[model samples]
Target: MKKLLKNIKLVLFFAGLVLVVFLANCGLTPLTIEVPSVVNANEVATFILNCGTEPRIANTDPPYTSKLIVGFMVPKSWKAAQNTTVELISSEKGNSTLVLIPSAEKEAASGLAWPDAAKKRFGIGPNLLDDFEWLVYRSVPAYTFINNEDIKFKVKISSKVGSENSFSRLGFFILSAKENLRPEDTDYTKYAFSNNFSVTNGEGDLVDYVNPQLAKVEPVKSLDNDFISLNFDAGIIETTLSNTDEIFLEARGFTKSGQQIAITTKVDKTRLKPLGGKKYRIDIWPRGLLNVPQNETLDRFEYYFTNAAGNAKVGYGNTADPFRYTFKCP
Candidate 1:
């Protein structure tokens, strides 16, 4: 019985030693993240990150601490607002510092690229913005120990108004001891985490960015056989236009036999002035300006208009209710 007890004791001792070694070898703790449930487009938002383990510089000639790099992935339809900036604040100290996140490719290229080990571990390739899909990363010197520290950061994001819809998912990443770390390092994965948060509208009204509305179209009297006058009620132009900007009118004529002909005419800014109230008018001469054959037009007309930005008003056709008019040769 005594010998058996000794053998059991030796086995227990060896197992405890092994467990201690394993714990000591494990360098980093898993990272934790928190983000807001909803964020507005073209607004600044806050995200929180907690670094589990203290970051340290492995080897330095002068014994200086390395850098902590934070990365963000902005979707293709989103853009970093002009003068977009980030502020990192330490939760414990309430101390904050300004960090610049570069939107330009020329500036971004100057940063360190992820090493092969990091790329393989995270399953990500070279980070680059494709078609306005931006990946912004910024690094700050790890001057203070950030073990289990909650770091709060503010980010400003703007939507490519017309390209983005009601929602977009943004990705985030963190790398500790970035200056001394390589992508291929065995510990790279341990000190990093990648996750995503979504930005969505709370009320769910996705406003149209550049849609122009055509309110009314009136066929003013045909001026002789050479020209036709049309009064266009182009409802409130929401977008501000420069002096050089132009609006175009598209007119389609259908004959009694159903043969269709179309022509486009440019309406200068001078003709698009306000008519008394909120309504605006544009006098168009589609026949003479577009060279539409006057002899072939026997029946109906369709009208559509567009601004210089390609924002078009809904097309009007012969089947339109209440105000539909059929052209008759007089």
Candidate 2:
């Protein structure tokens, strides 16, 4: 009976030790986010990352804090520049995963593969990020418990920035909890928090370049119809700079068979005529130019702008704003 009592006490002591270790392994860290209002294709947005007021033991041993990687998505029509730049704002102490993708078409050709889970989480596909490519830059290791309020570093964008038209510049503040951090434990109670920022110099209307008004597409009855039509208000950002050359428009169609038809040619910019202060519309149709088959599930459409110099930009285009009530024809 006495031996049984000793065994019970030992078991209880070990259990308590395990609990203490678990508590020590897991903690919390706060992360605040402040994204820029706008980022130009070729311009860089400077940012600051400061760890706020929080006092806790940072994981110093094998299991360190989480690692963060940043990313962005460019629009399809953007032409890749010769030299793209990405400058870090904070301490350039750690390694990052910065890469440049030429076009969504290059993904399949790049021979890159990922688990289904990561693919779905990041919305990886040919078109979702089709027209654009990617750029990645890796940073070195950094372990600074920034608990004070101060501005960080100034990261620069690529010199080969895509033209504002073709590139839909995006910023991603990515975090990976699995790196060096405790896997079995879920809570991060002892970490600090930070709010990121990007600097912007000016503001302009979406109409400055194209018509600020909405764009329309004349819907067709059959998917196999060889012709497609679209209409939209023009956008012109600069009034004084009237090199008013030719404007080009392009059409893309996503079919039910998981196929997309992109335009070999662009629309005309001169078609834009002012309706009011910043309102105008243009009608577009690829009659003999485009050969689109009649398919029942004609999903979406997009319109972009380009000048005679071949400079391009993407305006607004939609799938829900139907120009015609689609019906089957016997």
Q: Identify the leading candidate in terms of TM-score.
A: 1
The regions of model 1 sitting more than 4 angstroms off are 1-28, 55-64, 81-83, 91-98, 101-134, 139-163, 166-168, 177-181, 186-198, 201-330
**Candidate 1 residue-wise lDDT, 223-258, digit = tens:** 323333333333344422222224455556566667
Q: State candidate 1's TM-score.
A: 0.38
What tens digits encode model 2's per-residue C-alpha lDDT throughout 131-203?
3333333344434443222223333444333333221224333323233222232343122212222122332
Candidate 2, 131: how far from true, in Å? 4.4
Q: Report lDDT per candidate.
A: 0.42, 0.37
Best by lDDT: 1
How does model 1 fare in lDDT?
0.42
Q: lDDT for model 2, please.
A: 0.37
